[model samples]
Target: MRIAIDAMGGDFGPRVVIPACIDALTRHPHLSLTLVGQQDEISAYIPSAERQQFADRLTVLHADKVIGNTDKPSHALRQRKQTSMHEALCLVADGHAQACVSAGNTGALMALSRFVLKMLPGIDRPAIITAIPSRKGDSYMLDLGANVDCSAEHLLQFAIMGSVMTQAVAGIAEPKVGLLNVGEEEIKGNEQVKLASRLIKEHGGINYAGFIEGDDICAGKVDVVVCDGFVGNIALKSSEGVARLIGRQLRDGFSGSVFRRLLGWLVKPVLQDIASYIDPARRNGASLLGLQGIVVKSHGGADRQCFGYAIDQAVAEVSMDVPNCINRQLEKSIAIKYRLKRSP
Candidate 1:
């Protein structure tokens, strides 16, 4: 499958993204990538030998402009054309590529994706969903800064989409779905949460695990967690902060004292295992669910390996035909009939 990369979107631009594209090509020989960005800069990062070798597999699509971090989403949509980010998504929409990967401004990507690719049948708005590493496993969460204000019906849609995603990507037969709430009790949340709970529970096909507290998210009890963009974004940021804090504290504790340093050397292998388990790089890509085509967002600060994981995510979703899976499941469950036009 061919995946388009917005090589100019991330923090390091082509310096990081171009190398990651080469790495992905090396890993998946069948995979072809088209890097969209300033022609000269993108080409400069690629060595002559590897370029000649993968010439047929790797193509560069020159995009003169780039969407900057400070640009507003609305302005980016209205003004930025033929930009790396916009052109990348257009490749997916135009069927030139199966999926698109970008480490650009999240809001701009969302707006451009919605406008260019449109939304699938029965999906009102596109939701950003990503795997959050947990003790049990990775629990998928949705609406990560996509639609801050959502209705009960939106939450229900997020639930179905998240469930279908986990099943398809994670290969779980019947992934347990949960509604994020202040408390697990039925009486704890706002009106929308209560209504959403009833709707998801009433959907029948989804494995609704009822309301889940914030702590339950990482406890590994539930497979998919559903919430509004406001809540999901906050949870994502907070978790990231906590992950950094844990890593810092662990390093300081292990290396601060002479005795601890000796002990740390003894348990270095164990710490490596723990670090591998909790590494944020392992969970770098966040899928933009509900779009007509697959769009994977990489963190702007992500390195080559982390960005490659985002590309891998897009490849996996393309192989599984995620949009259709979600649509099929939505039709099967027919949760809260949405009066919207279907985009192909």
Candidate 2:
């Protein structure tokens, strides 16, 4: 499979993206990588020896402009053919590559993806979906920062898209779906939440688990959690912050006095394991669900390891044929709802 990388996007740009692409190429012999960025900068970072080793599978496509971190989404759409981000996305849309991976500005990537790849037939808008690690297992969440204000119909659409992807990617037969809200009771939450609940429950394909709270997300009570981007993005950032704080506090506590230092040394392996489990870089990629083609968005501040996870996600999605599976299952669910509504 071939994957395109927006090498000039993100905090480190080519410095981080290039290493991740090289590592992926080395790890997967059958895979080919196309780095889309300025030729000189991209080549400068890669050593000549290693470049020759993988010359057969590695190719760099020069792009003069790059989408800035603060570039407006509207402005990005206007310069479709110029930016590296747009060209990387076009690689997927044009069938030149199996997927496109970028650690670029989230807003610009979303706007460009929807325009270039178009939305699946029945999807109203594209959503950002990622796997959130939890105690019981990993749960899939959607609208991380895509549609801020979603209507009942949009929430229902998100559920269908999330459910289909969860099933295809996670291999869950009927993934349990939950609506994130302040309380789990039917009486709680805004009118939109209540109405969305009813719509999800009525859908024949979705395994609606009713409403779930913020705390329930890490508890892994449901397989898929659905929310608007406004709430989902805040929740995601807050969780990342809390994890860093707790990890720092623990490390500080362990390094205090002689006895504490001795104990810390003995438990270093355990702490390392815990750190690995909670590491954001270990799980950084998010799929722009509902697009016609595969596009994985890496975190804007991602390093080589973090960005590599994004490439892994793209590879997995491509192998699973995620877009085709989602399109079929989504239309099936919509048809089921229509039939039930008309049955009298």
Candidate 3:
């Protein structure tokens, strides 16, 4: 499978993108990569021997322009037609690549993707879905930032999409869907939450697990959490911020005193493993759901390792045929729901 990458979109640009592409090619022999960026800059990162190793498997497309972080989403999409990110997405749209991954301005990515690829049938809006580590394992959260304000119908659609995505990516069967609310009670949240709960409960297509409070997210009470992008974004960022704070405290405590220092040396390996598991850079990337093809959005500040992980994620999505599987599931569920609703 061929994966298209926006090499000039992230903070590290070709320096990290080139190495990560090489690493992915080494590990997955069948994987081909199309780097979208300035050809000269990309060539500088890949040595002659390494280039010869991959040979025709690797190709670089020149994109003289770039989308900056400060540019307005609409303006950038309109002005920077030759941007690396836009060019990479064009590869996917034109069937040149199975998937596209970028660590650029998220707004531009979202806007361009929606405009070029369009939304899936029956989906009102595409959601930004990501896996969040929980006590019971990883849980999927949708509308992470795609839509700041969403209607009850929009949220219900997110629940359906999130449920299918969790099953496809997390290997969960009959994934339980939860509506994020201030309380676990059905009537506790705002008008939107209450209306969404009613629809979810009566929809019969999804495995609705009632309302879930914010605290229940980390507790792993449900496999899929659905909320408006406004709320979901806050929850995701809050969890990430807390994790970083804890990691800093651990580092300081370990080096603060001799006794702690000895303990640190003994448990350093274990701590490192835990930190890696919760690192925002490691889990910061997300997929734009409801599109025709796979599109991964990595953190703008992602390093080489983070970019590598994003490539792995893109490969998984493409290999698993996540979009096809999700579309099939959605069709079956909607069909069943329509028949049931007409019954009695």
Candidate 4:
């Protein structure tokens, strides 16, 4: 499999992205990587020994321009044709690479991806979906800052796409799909959530699990959670904040006294495992679902390891043929629904 990397997209530029690409190449030997960015900057960071080791599997595509973090998506789309992010995505659109990964501006990335790759036949818009650690394992949530305002139909579309993605990428058969709402009762949510629930339940393809509250997300009540981008993004950021707070408090309490410090030492292994599990970097990849081709988005501030995780995500999706799976599932569901509607 071959994947394109936006080497100059993230806050740290090639410093983080280049190492991440190297790490991904080392881990996935069958993979080929094409780093898209300024050739000189990318080459300066990659040591000659490392380059020689993976010479056959690695290639650099020079792109002199870069899309800035704060650049407006509209302006970037029109003016940033020569940017690393745009070119990297172009590689996927042209089928030169199987997938593309970028830690660039979310809005700009989405705009460019949709314009270049186009949405699937039945999909009106592409939703952003990512995995988050949960008690049952990991839960996939969609519309995370992609489409802030969504309709009932959009939410239903998100449910279908999220369910298919979880099943394809995570190896979950019949993944339980949940609508993110304020309450578990069918009558509790607003018009959009309530209607989305009805639509999902009516659709036989998904394993609809009714409504799930915010707390249920961490408890792992469902494998897939669907919501508008506004709510999903807020929930994601808030959960991240709480995780940081708890981690900090635990560290401070553990160092408060000799006895506590000793206790901390005793539980050091357990704590380390928990820390790694909740680490955002480990879950750095978010898919731009509903697109015709596969595109993975990494956190703009992600480190080398985090960015590498994003690359891994792109590889997994490419290997699993996630976009094609979603297309097939969606077409099947629509066919079933059409038949049902025509029946007495």
lDDT of each: 0.92, 0.91, 0.89, 0.92
TM-score for predicted model 1 compared with the true structure: 0.96
lDDT at 3 for candidate 4?
Answer: 93
TM-score of each: 0.96, 0.97, 0.96, 0.98
lDDT of 3: 0.89
Error of 4 at 127 (Å): 0.9
For candidate 4, write residues 1-344 as lDDT tens digits.
99999999988989999888888888998999999999999999998998999999999999989899999999888877789999999999999999999999999999999999999988999999999889989999988999999998899889999999998889999899989999998789898888888888888899999999999988999999999999999999988888888788889979978999999999999998998888767899999999999999999999989998999999999999999999998899889889999999
Candidate 4 Cα lDDT to native: 0.92
Candidate 4: the clashing residue pairs are none
Stretches off by above 4 angstroms in model 3 are none
| Candidate 2 vs 3: which has more TM-score | 2
Top-TM-score candidate index: 4
Q: Give the per-residue lDDT of model 1 (tens digit) for 129-247.
A: 99998888899999899999999999999999999999999999999999999999998889999999998987778999999988988999899999999999999899888888888
Each model's Cα RMSD: 3.5, 1.1, 1.4, 0.9
- lDDT for residue 275 in candidate 1, whole number 0-100: 79
lDDT of 2 by residue, 197-286 (tens): 998888777899999999999998999999999999998888888889878988999987999999999999999998888776778999
Ranking the candidates on TM-score from highest down gives: 4, 2, 3, 1
Please tell me which model should have the higher lDDT, number 2 or number 3: 2
Q: Is candidate 1 or candidate 4 better by TM-score?
A: 4
Candidate 4: worst 10 consecutive residues by lDDT? 274-283
